[model samples]
Target: MSKSIHKPGFVLGDALDIPTFKVLKQDGTLYKGAQEPEFDKEMALKLYDDLVFIRVLDERMVGAQRQGRIPFYLASLGEEAASVGSAGALKPQDMIFAQYREQGALRHRGFTVDQFMDQCFSNDRDLGKGRQMPIHYGSKALNYNTISSPLGTQIPQAAGYAYGQKLDGLDACTICYFGEGAASEGDFHAGLNMAAVLKCPTIFLCRNNGYAISTPSAEQFSGDGVASRGIGYGIATLRVDGNDLLAVYAATAAARAYALEHNAPVLIEAMSYRLGAHSTSDDPTGYRSKDEEAQWAKKDPILRYKHWLTQKDWWSDEQEKTLYAEHRANILAAMKAAEKRPVPTIDHLITDVYDEPTPHLRQQLKQLKAHMRKYPEQYPKTSGRLDA
Candidate 1:
């Protein structure tokens, strides 16, 4: 029951262009026809505080990495609103599956500064038992899945998880975060297709931040952007200015509602720029020009939101100064504390995989201990200490 064209033809993918949704201007003013999201002062202040916290945390952690305190780090830098703003729109009960850079999302869910530091430093207090690298954060309490190293793995996993949620009759959806580069993975296709076909309540948020660890978006794909791919998968799609906090929040709130109401999938493509180097190990100077970075810097999401708060008489310059100073001191103290804490004991390697350590795992741990004893200098003495 389909109408066909008389001549053989194909839809021109490149001809499709998705408009970027924006609510606030760079100067903190709303666009002529744009509407602000329904955010109360308390919620707004909390989100703003989170933005400041993550910005400060990113700055301090990057410095720590440079100082050889932490092994590696990633900075959200210019894309704060993309993570924090979207998180602000979601309910606490909803599950979140994030790529590494969505620390802002974790922070929004009450992940403490100390928790971040513990994970980054791989300290004993870390919930992950010092297994994950810096920025690989997760919390069962917060409903955030533990981040895995492989890119795009969370996409399909989120789809399946959301289906389970649907079957359970839960009043929540699953939100998955990833970069534009990860969208190129086959997992993205499989996840989107599965969600669409299964009618799972899921939101796939893509931070199209212009690069995937040095490869620019121009080289990554040829379509209009990631949003186009979402449409291709038969999912509702929204494109938003990632630097606009109000825009991101509004769009995500809408996406969540639509997905839950219809028991369907939605895709959000946040257009942003990675102002900082991809990670501590990267140097953007090699792949991008300083001028390009400067242009994006002018659109800093935190500053824009700060201006809007000040305009509404909610925040002031004194408060801004005090906040920056306070967060800086707090993050530094947490980092120092985490640095001094001992790493997880050797037994942790064999634990958490089963109800009890299996015989093979115990043997493996015994072998590891013996290996460490044979070369004490090769490993940290504290890490090798096991209960006798």
Candidate 2:
């Protein structure tokens, strides 16, 4: 039998228009037809508290970077709900493959303020052992993968990890977080295709925050958005207002249920705006206007959630003030302690890769130590204890 060549009738203008799902309004009121998720007063208050804590942390850390206390930092300034809400919906056993800006997810998963400061300072107490740059976090206890600096690398990795989970007969999935800018990478396509083919339980969360560094979304792609691409790959997809906590939480909960029950992948494109500079290294004034930032500031997720909590009488203005004061003091103290700690030991440089250091690496380390000895005065006091 010969293969039949069939071309289905199709029209270019008949493409599907993906809708953005939203629940909470700018004033924190639910839309008339919007259904509230399974959130209760206690959960709502905790989410609100996390949102505020993350905001304060970002503000203080950015100031620290300005003061040269930290080398670099990335703030989730305008996109707290996207990270925290979605993370709140997931089970603790579920793993997270994060890009740098999802610190709120870690915080929601029990990462401490001291741990954040330790990683930022790259001190001996850091779990990553002074390896990663500031803001790149990881916690095995929390099942959050260590963040890599390369964009889109985690997409395919998430698929592979989920496949492993499936093989192990575990009821857990992996959530991969990236920016819209990362959707341009080849790994994005590869990851989605692999997940669809293997039926891996993975959620690809893309934060479509208007700009990729300084490049605007208008210049990034011509398609509807990242959410639309999921249709091409046969994956369940959703587009949500990233600033709306209730909407994000509801959508993520549904996505998790679908992925786990069907053993399939889902993609959530979070429509949001980065209300701060891309990082401490960049200046927002170069590409955005003050008026534009002020406009988004009006939709601040933390304040929006606060309004909802207050309306339910679960929160008060006095509580907000006290929470902010306590967080600020805790962060300041943590930063001071982290800064005073010692850097990773010199021998740690040759560890964690193998049971024994390779001859080439040992030789390199020896040469590095000789060079450091030759230039001891130039090195700082915290530069590793070579003898021990």
User: Please, what is the TM-score per model?
Assistant: 0.98, 0.96
Model 2 C-alpha lDDT per residue in residues 1-388, reported as the tens digit of each score? 8466688755352277889999988887889999888878888878887888899999999999999988899999999999999999999999999999999999999999999999999988999989889999999999999999999999999999999998899989999999999999999999999999999999999999999999999899988889888888999999999999898999889999999999999999999999999999999899999999999999998888888888888888899889999999999999999999998877778888899999999998889888888888877763557655
Off by over 4 Å in 2: 1-10, 382-384
- lDDT for 156 in candidate 2 is 97
Summarize candidate 1's per-residue lDDT along 243-305 as a digit string, tens digits. 999999999999999999999999999999999999999998999999999988998999999
C-alpha root-mean-square deviation, each candidate: 1.2, 2.4
Q: Supply candidate 1's per-residue lDDT for 75.
A: 94
Error of 2 at 298 (Å): 1.2
C-alpha lDDT of residue 170 in model 1: 93
Q: For model 1, how many clashes?
A: 0
User: Which lDDT values do the candidates have, in the order given?
Assistant: 0.93, 0.91
Tell me the lDDT of candidate 2: 0.91
